[model samples]
Target chain A: MVIYGVALLSFCMLVGVFLGDLLGELIGVQANVGGVGIAMLLLILLSNLTSQRFSLAPMTESGIHFWSAMYIPIVVAMAARQNVVAAVSSGWMAIIAGVAAVAASFLLIPVLSKAGRGRPE
Target chain B: MSGDVLARVLTENSLIAAFVVVGALVMVSYWLSARLTRGHIHGSAVAIALGLLLAYAGGVATGGSKGLADIGVFAGIGIMGGAMFRDFAIVATAFGAELEALKKAGLVGALSVVIGVVLSFVVGALVALAFGYTDAVSVSTIGAGAATYIVGPVTGTALGASSEVVALSIAAGLTKSVLVMIGTPLVAGRIGLDNPHSAMIYGGLMGTTSGVAGGLAATDPKLVPYGAMTATFYTGVGCLLAPSVLYLVVRAVL
Candidate 1:
């Protein structure tokens, strides 16, 4: 049952990556264009469509949910690892950009909070 | 089986082995977070730090481009950790989010996204300039990274910036994400960051979905959905603006 869900995810991923590659080619970029985002959208669409049209087994639904939950941690770990390696080899500019972005966002909080206040709920 | 055959099999299926290693590292990172930070800092952050250390060590050991993947048996990490999976994970998070909740944030939430993207881009661009990155592509790419990690690479790829600049953008975004995860709870009360409306606004302002979600989870689990809702929009908005409007503006300035 869970395997079915993985099958669906894999199918979506395949189509999404295909389209992403196509889009990248069209746009003249040498990379996948939002492949993961497209796959996720496709999964959401298919899941919603199927749930409305036919009943899904509880196991099938849970299977999908399991993958969804595991998605973030795994992806984050991978990306963060790659990013750190890239940043280290790149230069100090990356470090400066990182530190500066954090500091800037922190400072923006007060300004944003002030603007958010006294508004009607 | 012969020893040579076994070695070949392991090398050929090394990616799976990499996954197992990464999973173990994640568990260890969580344990360290629980023991050292008392769960105050999110385990993901710790895991990332440990991952960086491992990556650095792997690079030093192998002197290869793909880090640990260059070690043969860990080659699966390259595919497992690729863009396909990265985007898949991001899109998957949206499945459980309710469309109705997005309406509650209304105009303020919309405005927050605009303000958040522009402010972050400006700050990121300024930082790029400070670092002597005068090119518009580098500046806008880093600026988009400040908007969100996803936006950074998308814009960089579209703009034809170098991979190094894109990597910098991602690092910048990750730093912001970690800080938001850590800072939200400590400043929640002082900044009046309570309730769904405030959470939506906070999410819009912060713009990092994971950071906003993690922070909201720490502040009040109830607020996670609302915050994530707006934060998701923030990513979309950033993606739309970064390569076109923001890139043009940076080009004009520099």
Candidate 2:
């Protein structure tokens, strides 16, 4: 039951995201990715609420299993793309970009900290 | 060549191979993560890995160049899938929790998170307009959840544009890095010794939404710069991290 629950949730969320994307395209209103995110989030909330109202055990955490396992095949394939990655010569750019970004993140963290400072009370 | 091997793999028995390979990898990651993290592994990672595998298999079988572009595209789309998948999980899990009377009130609790996502998008969109960047939907997902999956691929797509995707992705990475760096501090300020991480998370969510909203809103076609900046800032940190992330994978091959 737990396993099925998690699977059901995942499937629903996937459908929601896909649907949201399609909706955005069809409506031409441009809700952005948040539409899908919000949709899935709402679905999860709804599913959990409905299940509880009926008294069911929480869904299994199998999606985590499914998610973690995906990397192996990707890494393996990327391993196969070594030569293409090598020829790019853009490695330096990536490095520079990475360093700069990291540095920016470091700087931004404190600024955000300062900016976010407040208590509703 | 690897491509030839993939071709053979596909021609001989592609569907079976894909199933077996993906299933095995999923199990392996599950086992490893469960064993190491004690079942704490994230579903997003698994989804990403699956997306990459599927993309690669499809690309290779179809004779697409096994180049950065193909892989990057795979990664971008995978990120999109992964992000949505996680959102689904979060919502589902929350719902499951509510159903079983595990914790938190049902609708109200769920609404809190939904509200967060919406507010994040509004802020992200405004910020993008102020900064000047592209108005792609991928940018909208930045702050939503597990946007890393979308960020890389978005950058890949940006490369195909006249603006250059790598640069854009790298820019996105930089933005994330900045968000993370400043996010900690920013949240600290607002929450007042509360969970600083949450603030950063919210910021990221907002940043990405801002990008997407801004991008779509910038239909004039001249607001590309604003859209790009908005998009990059939202996913900047993730994009910047792409090189090293990909480098590590490439390094393993060597």
Candidate 3:
């Protein structure tokens, strides 16, 4: 069952990476574009569309959920690959830029929520 | 001879070794989050902080480019942390976001994605300009990173930015993610972030899924799915816009 989730994710990855590469080519870029994003969308589309039809077993579904929660470890692994020391040693430019962007975005939340206030679900 | 054989075996199965190391690291981070921060700072944020420090230590120790992955037993981290698994994990996160829940996010939830991406990009770009990173490619790549760590590298790669610039972009994105994680709970009360609607808006604006998810988990567990769903959308929006539209905007400014 767990393997099944991996199998499904593998299919999505192949198709998504291909599409992303094609998108890059279409846009004249030399790199893969939106590959992960495309893969994720495909996973969402496939799982939602198929769950009703498949009625997968409870254990199987949990296996899928378990993988979904794998976000933390995988993210840590991704972060581990980065050269943090060098990036920091270069300058404070990146640090300040990132902080400024987040601060501005955080401050905008109050204003943005105003648009949602009237349309409660 | 036995010790040498064991060492060889561990190196041969480096990915397995990486799992062991990372698993322990995550456990310690969670323990720290629970005990040290009293859950105000989520374990995910703590894990990321520890991971970055370890990467730094590894880099300094080996003077290697791949960070911790450069060491013999840790070499598997190179593949474990590569784009394939990163994307796999990211894609899987949206699996539980049933379409019905998505529809409930509504217009403001949708608007947040676009606004968040562009606003973050512009702020990052302005900082880049101010700090002497004036070129369109550098500015936009860093700007895209400010949107999210994922977006930063994607835009940098698409624009063919140098590896150092890409690294810087990623560093910037990581900082944003950590900040959002730590800051969300502290600001939740003042900003009225108790409901699903606002969580979605918050996610869109913040644009780091893990950060938003962790923060919301600390503030209110029920809102995690809503906020995470839209934060995921923000990354998608950022990936698309930062490399193309935002890059052009930066070019015009330059």
Query: Could you say which candidate leads in DockQ?
Result: 3
Least well predicted 10-residue stretch by lDDT in candidate 2 chain B: B214-223
Candidate 1 local lDDT, B1-254, one digit each (tens): 69878668768886676677778877887899899999976676566556556656666777765555566666677666564554455455545555445455556776887888888888888888887888899889998888777889888988999998887888778667656765677778776777766777787788876577556655665565566556655766677788988889888888
After TM-score superposition, the amount by which residue A57's alpha carbon in candidate 1 deviates from its true location, in angstroms, is: 1.4
Question: Which regions of candidate 3 fall more than 4 Å away from where they truly are?
Answer: A27-38, A50-54, A117-121, B1-3, B38-40, B106-110, B132-145, B148-203, B206-254
Report how closely model 3 matches the true complex, as a DockQ value.
0.49
- CA shift at A40, candidate 3, in angstroms? 3.9
Give TM-scores for every candidate, taking all chains together and pairing residue i with residue i: 0.68, 0.41, 0.77
Model 2 misplaced regions, further than 4 Å: A1-11, A22-31, A57-88, A91-95, A110-117, B1-254
Rank by TM-score, highest first: 3, 1, 2
Say which candidate scores most in lDDT: 3
Best by TM-score: 3
Q: After best superposition, candidate 2 residue A32: deviation in angstroms?
A: 4.0
Residue-level lDDT of model 3, residues B77-164, one tens digit each, is 8887776666566566666665655566657887998999999898888888888887899989989988888888989988999998
Which stretches of candidate 1 lie above 4 Å from their native place? Answer: A7-55, A89-91, A106-121, B1-7, B42-44, B63-66, B106-113, B131-244, B247-254
Poorest 10 consecutive residues of model 1 chain B by lDDT? B83-92
TM-score of chain B of each: 0.65, 0.32, 0.71
